[model samples]
Target: MKNTFNIHEVSNLLDVSIPKLLLWEKKNKLVPTEKDTNGINIYLKNQLVDFPIAKDVFESKWDEEIKIKPLGSYNSIELFAGAGGMALGFEKAGIHHVLLNEIDKFSCSTLRKNRPEWNVIEDDIKNLDFKKYANKVEIVTGGFPCQSFSAAGKKLGFEDTRGTLFFEFARCIKEVQPKIFVGENVKGLFHHDKGRTLQVIKDTIHELGYTLIEPRVLKAMYYKVPQKRERLFLIGIRNDLAEKNNDFKFPAPYKKVLTLTDAFKKGDLFDNDVPESIGDMYPARKKEILDFVPQGGYWKDLPDDLQREFMQRSYFLGGGKTGLARRLSMTAPSLTLVCSPSMKQTERCHPLETRPLTIRESARIQTFPDEWEFVGPKSQAYKQIGNAVPVNLAWSVARSIIDYLNKINVDNRKNTKTILQSESV
Candidate 1:
């Protein structure tokens, strides 16, 4: 049937990996109008574009990556710097980290442990003053936890966001007055408070004399992270620079979609297989029930008796509870990592073993390098890794920002030269 291509079939037809296709769908590029009984995406034939362009976009990853380099030295200040995933990635992209701020003690410890040279500020964002960094930092970035602004005010400007963490983020941007600012958060912010929240954000950016590039949700899997995590990015450029030229580009997707095999086994993602580390263990009964579920399978794969025992009353409820008793497939990217792996509604069992993923395994899934260690207890380490942006994904975004900043730097040089020429005349 023309409309019968499942996810696998589409992957083969387009020569793109399953994760890339899913990323396209997330951006509303190639939406599957239907799904098969097995819950696989069923794409229609008419939805596809020509094969040549599709191949170019999906296959030219390495070529695009080789072109990403900073034209000039750029410095950045990072906020909500959880375990330094984004900050590290930016550093790898040739952007220097002038400072990093985080409220979590364990996460701050992790940042300091890995990069002692970094000015790691371990304090609440509200207590800090960003005015000193004005004109000193070119970029400001953060994965600010999403919080709704109060609707009690008439205008949804900077002041309206007060009493929320986002206000602190806004205050930093206003004070620092960086050339560019990047704010990352969950995808749900797009629709939060029936879209009023994002509108307020846009309004606040305008009030701060910056132009907002339309926010986009990037899938980490497409950027070499072996996980299905997604984050929404809001990028703003100072109005003066934007007025002169504003051409910010989002990063290109990597060609290959990695899997748990790439993560846990010796392959492209890692030099050695996942190392031994502390991990959570399933209780006796939970382990017994999950043992029956096969790789890539979930609650439906279990026998009727075990399913009933595991799901309890929810088994009789509607909708497919796929995450229940789920075991990751070695062939596909792992599901989004949460603060804890053994959560009942979102179980993250190992593909082969009957236990939850170890702290190192979780970090690897988030594309955090092995040597980039996490501090504190196992639970805290897991929390830090789970809450981080994928390093490679962050690197991709940073490269794009660098590209734009390079252009700005060239423009600035030209302007100075023109002014000198006129003065001599």
Candidate 2:
């Protein structure tokens, strides 16, 4: 078997485009071990060890499912629970849900339709009180939108975040006092507000009596999802629990980086071909222009005149504009999905067909089960699916958190036993 990878192979392995690989080389982020006779970059497996995703791909643990049972009846209350991606994953990992709050009626209905037994609350998070669930639930999780806080020269505190959704998330933590909390956000949050926003979040976590784990941005592809979506996850353990135990690690990546074929066709990720369903369609002019783009090709692939016709003013713009008039490749993972597939700035045309991906197809790419139907109009459904965290990715992270909670459970039991023995003595 070939142990070294050429530039093209490395591109496929990393889900990064060839240009991006070259860019990494230019920035000294990725160094090639050697060059082929044709002067193409060739990298040994060990040379890619610095990238966690590359390391996982080289030595995958995908053969085994991450199976972990909840040590106890661990209950969680999820806020901003749009369409239940994380909730479902947490449930699959054996965490029970006490409540799920979402502001969107369509999303709330989708959650209720799938799991009628769940306490799906369709209300503004600000209107709901989490104090009732204090001491009742072990975890509080939310995918809060990142919003900036008004600040002078002074350092921002928990109260300074009051106007943003993150404040609501922190309010729940303060009220519920869960043993652990998880916050999910777009990867951009890492650098938002020139890093000041993240600093405030870190300060708030400390104020709320929890120890925030060094946050990490997890790629969906590494976690068994067939989409190149990236999400930043923040895990915080209550101060008391943090002191009791110190070992906590993120979930390991899968062995194989799944592709569009794994998502749409019968394979390890799914049992059958993606079922047909309604999806958005491109206009005649848009469709005709995109027809010329080849598989995995974007606007640059179009003829000079046609590229000018399709791109108009954007044609003169400086950026690569890679997403415009782009077609997915059957062999690689799909690009991160946007709210609508037909948008010119980020077109998501089907691999073989000229149309946009159907409702079910989009769900599969996000690792949603076939039967896990989205209950709304095509546009609303697309929005729900596009905005969701990949279900498989959530499941992987949830398993790790559950493992940590289990360890804490054991420590608590040991401490109790010791105290009882001291009383008897």
Candidate 3:
């Protein structure tokens, strides 16, 4: 019944050599073990359960803990804001929000309902000119939709990227000329169109006189988010800003991993039990079929005849087909919450209940606080919650940005002093 394991057991389970484990311990890649009076290393068993090594031994080493410096009152403007997930995170990190641009009526309403003081723009981004914010905002952030560019012509430029939301995002960056800019997208952006999509984005940022910081795919689970969502983070420092200092780094990963229980029950994530709310209902036939799935079980748990009827040709295909009729496990993070948690192709049934997770349940899994409410109908609410960046994940990233900005400020002061002394000489 014990979830935790010892260091030796972890070494054996991971098939990693003792020397490699020692190296990991030294590099801070593995959890530091407690030491006895005799200096013997002892690791907690539960810590090993969610360690990255146990999940995928070949996983990259990008999940190191990030240190963040607190920078108070740093001004920021967010574009393509959806239900304020990223904005909430930045606020938690002590960043000041000057404006938030969101095109969805429901989402804009949701923002206003929660934080009436926020300057929420409810119009299309293309219609609004950001010239007024020139040299005013310190940071510009957005989660622009990823779209493929025409390959027939030269590499996509700012003009060619027109008619796309990313172009609008780029336009805002140009107009504001913020010291730093952060853009996020799905992991698919990395491989979209043989990687040309990301390449063009980087080139465009360079054209705008900003230095791209080797964009990376940040895993939500690593940052205390209970889902397996991966977001591509694009950070750019204005050329002038980068020349002043180069010590900027991303936020470090949390020491612990969160699970479904963490989201719904009293724990580090939430203080009270999840509030009961309205959710989409399943049809009679689908409900009857889903009733058979046990906690953590999926379509494979159904009767053979039922499997054939439900899966159709997909049953004949390869792999585990894990997502089909999948009931979540309380011990691990919930699978990515989709707009329709009850759909057959991407079912996200409650671990105990036969029905889909409610709108509030979905929001909790994304790290949205209990007070934050979604707007519009049940479906639109689900879409906003499902599409949001995990608020805690955003806080971690924002902390890193604040640290970089502090370093920039310090360097600027030093440079200014040197120029003053030179002119006097």
Candidate 4:
């Protein structure tokens, strides 16, 4: 592809809001080459191509060749490592997994089965001591569950949070003191307990002497995953490290969105068709009802009589309630995969099939390699995949984090040299 396009042309092509575009540029999320003599921002065709959304611009061609930088040799430790989704992404991003901790036997088995070299610590976080990792690992990451505090008492502090998994996460951070740490959770975390839950998390991180980035809800579609998952990312840099520089940036979104067709077919993300695997079956009546829904269609697509019958009282409800009796679309990203795709509130019927997505299909939508297998019963497999951070999305984020850390190391070396030269003088 030719490598230059002006801002206006790029804007029109990408369909992004002008203000949001400017914000992206200013925040250094996507940088333009230079301005023309007329003072209009002139972006190189390469710049437009490099834009996160540019993946869509060259979808057919680039999708086949999109490459990810391999994880280098830097070491990391993971907490709450469910089936190693984030671990695999970070591994792909080039970080070496020094150790991983998870309490679930099935998840632990999944990790060990996939990465025998990894030191899988299979036990509760509270039983482990993280002090051994102090000054040893470069990063610590976790996806601690969110829990509400008793508001009838004093403002929630570290002690008040003791019984929750998040507290264990905090304790590990306090003990390990890695140069940087990452926390991931559901997007609903932002509004949990009217925002106080998030506030407490921030305060806890600050108390542990880290500089917290303003957390963001990164959409999976923006990162090339064929599922519409949203994750809240919490990044913290040790206060001492942040004092040295402030140019960290998040990963750029992929240019193109992926669809179910891109996921199951031979494509950049996978080499061949998804592997055949065991999957959940719908009841006979449920199957009959879902059969009426068209590809990319939902309950509303059913004949009015059937809709009224299936929806029953919910039919009279005020909102789209679209997720109910929903079938997926091949063209659009799949709805967020839940532990149970057949649940009343979160149906994820296949675009064409009458039943819910198969376990392999769920894995593909989350960007797992075709060879990766889940080590559990089918239902447990669904749960593991549903709870995972999309591997590609995590890879994108990990790449940005690595880039930031490398920059920090370089700046530190430069500063050290300057100090030594000054002293000699």
Candidate 5:
């Protein structure tokens, strides 16, 4: 999904200075894929994939790495904890998990197998009562799946979304009323139902007496994630807490971007090169057509007749189905990973190999530590990794949350001292 653009457009699009763009070109960091009639450099989409920020393009940056440690004894509860991506990130950021709830047995097994110490509760969120943790847990977070909520009338509120998983997410917030809550979902939720879905969610959070921070789509690529994955993040502070401290800052961006090499090879992100694991195989016919599709090339790279033969009825289709028989480029960041790597609509063929990416390779793209073992069948494992928040992305956000909470804690201690002095006087 890369596109061609001029230097000036690329500079503006990436927020990099024109001089820097030229410097990159000079160093061969970016080479022109094509030259226009006027001899202006026309950059390919792949050239920009591992360096793009504020957008879908995958990129990386190196800033002062946050030295994460417990600000204090902070406790958190996670819901819909799929493969412990966000939970593990928060754990690294120094927050202790009181309990993590997930409905899927396979995912729960994965969580337990990896971290036997974690208190993982395998159950439906609707069946859980979070009231016991009210005013106890400092934070609550979830990557709650988005489900359509039908409106019987114009007054769409919490009750209107009763059966959806997001309702359970909100219900927990309403029950536990944690000091802070973070929710994540796919970026499409922003425009789902013409934006009405998010509006209803906002309204429900407000109804629970929490001050909502204007939701922002956090690109995983911008936060040390190697793939082009974007997650929409929603954070809320309890009304009282927000009133006391209205300044809650988010994490800062990295100065240098990470590349696919940083992910699979022995680099800053990992200790050693990615270990080979079992992966799905391509059918003989599919392999033959894909053999011609060069690295970074998709179905469009096939010969005209071969394309027609492979596409079948869809051979006459107008738009380019770019994902079919795709081969990834080692130099460029991987595309947004899908649950199934071999699907015709979203093929993620290995950069050099003829088959799809392995489970370890997929996990590497997700920024999960090499040691984290995913339980269950390979298919289920792929689905969980594909559906996770990038671990590094969550860690960056967690550091910000910890910093905010640290300030609040200090202020509370000072206030307590002042009140004590007054009473003594």
Candidate 6:
């Protein structure tokens, strides 16, 4: 890959906006190298690499050899497995799914329709007892929704969260006692309830005999997903092994960012162009109105009167409602996906087309393979895609877990052999 880039090129490469780049430039953090013949400023790769965050910036070229799958026999049990996003990532990482639990019937159908061999358990997580799986799988994972607790007397234990789904997640961890468990949720959970919720989660995991690592918000763009979605992952290593190993590092970020163009076209990310599929559409009036909104423009781009008509009372409100009538740019990563792209507040207008993203397009943004079919109505399909942890992001995290589990297996073998030798003597 070239070691130099122009200002706009750097902005696209780093997922940083032009204004932010200008600010960095003013701060002497992002300096330019020599200029090209057209007088456009060129930035050497070394210049951006000086910043800690952008240090790994490089062009993304997919290599079949760099793909990491499971190193050995590792099994996992998943909860709240909506549409199989996280599970599919682990599947690519080489972890076999012994059983997957999902309460949504449509999501469960989607999972089974795609992977019939999987044991898809469709029931509320609270109804199921995962105790039977104790020692059965090396890992347990879930993307549980966050909920507030009563803040009843400091050290939050498992029972204190009884009424919440997070409690169910903790209960599963306690019962199954896997070597490690992964919990994922939206980034807001880290600060939900003014941080009490996250503190409670930490305390509860400790009470269940697991050591919680500092929660990390992983960016999807850095992990091969062509969207700027961010997910927080909570990793817990069972106390016994945690004390022995003591460290769990996250996977390294990829050097390059993946853009929507990489996602939709026949390129490094996919063998063929994105397949056409059904998606929701705006009303006739909306279609006519959206037709006037230029590519990369949003509701704010509309004429003054139309803006007021489109945004209603929100037109008079303060902060920029940037998502309104927003059109995506192909050169950059897509914005975080909402459940329904055509929703009034979150209009994801296609870069060239005036329509919302199609089902397959959205799935591609979420990093699902083209063959992975989604079931149910278009609305349900959208919800499933929106709710999923981007598969590539999950796969990135899973690689670290696989590395740790492989180490634990090696240690276990040594311990077993030593015990046998001692008994024989």
TM-score of each: 0.88, 0.91, 0.84, 0.84, 0.86, 0.93
lDDT of 2 at 61: 54
Q: Per-residue alpha-carbon lDDT of model 6 for 23-132, expressed as tens digits? A: 98789877677778897768988777655556654533234323645557898999999999999999888899999999999999999999999999999898998888
lDDT of each: 0.87, 0.89, 0.82, 0.82, 0.83, 0.85
lDDT (Cα, tens digit) per residue for candidate 4, span 1-425: 45665665565446453567789998997677888888777777555555545655555332322353433357898999998889999988788988899999999999989899999999988899989889888899999998886641466567667778888998988888888899999999998988888878887888889999889998887787987788999999999999887677777766556678888888856889877888888999889988999876678889999899899998998688878899887766788899886798899998878888998999999998877888988878899999999999988889878877887777878999999999999
| Model 6's TM-score against the true structure | 0.93
How much is the lDDT of residue 284 in candidate 4? 93
Q: Could you tell me the C-alpha RMSD of candidate 1 in Å?
A: 5.4
- For residues 1-425, write the lDDT of model 5, one tens digit per residue: 23677765575347555568778889988777887999877987666767536344323222443864555888999999999899989988899999999999999999999999999999988889988998899999998888777872467788877888889999999888888999999999998888878888888888889999888887675677777687888999999899999888767655434557767899868999999888899999988888888877887788998888878888787787878777876655677899898999899998887889999999999999988999999999999998888898999899878877887898899999999999999
Question: How would you encode candidate 1's per-residue C-alpha lDDT over 1-425 as one tens digit per residue?
Answer: 23456786566445466778999999998889988889899876566545553344445465566477887778899999999889988988899998899999999999999999999999999999989989998999998887778862368888888888888888999999999999999999999888888888888889999999989998887787888888999999999999988778888776556789999999988999999999999999999999999987899999999989999999889688878899997877889999998998999999999999999999999888999999999899999998998998898899888888988989999999999999999
Q: Considering summed lDDT, which 10 consecutive residues are worst modelled in model 2?
A: 58-67
Candidate 3 local lDDT, 73-132, one digit each (tens): 689999999999999999888888999999999999999999999999999998999999
Candidate 1: residue pairs that collide: none
Cα-based lDDT at residue 171, candidate 1: 93
How close to the true structure is residue 277 of candidate 5, measured as C-alpha lDDT? 88
Top-TM-score candidate index = 6
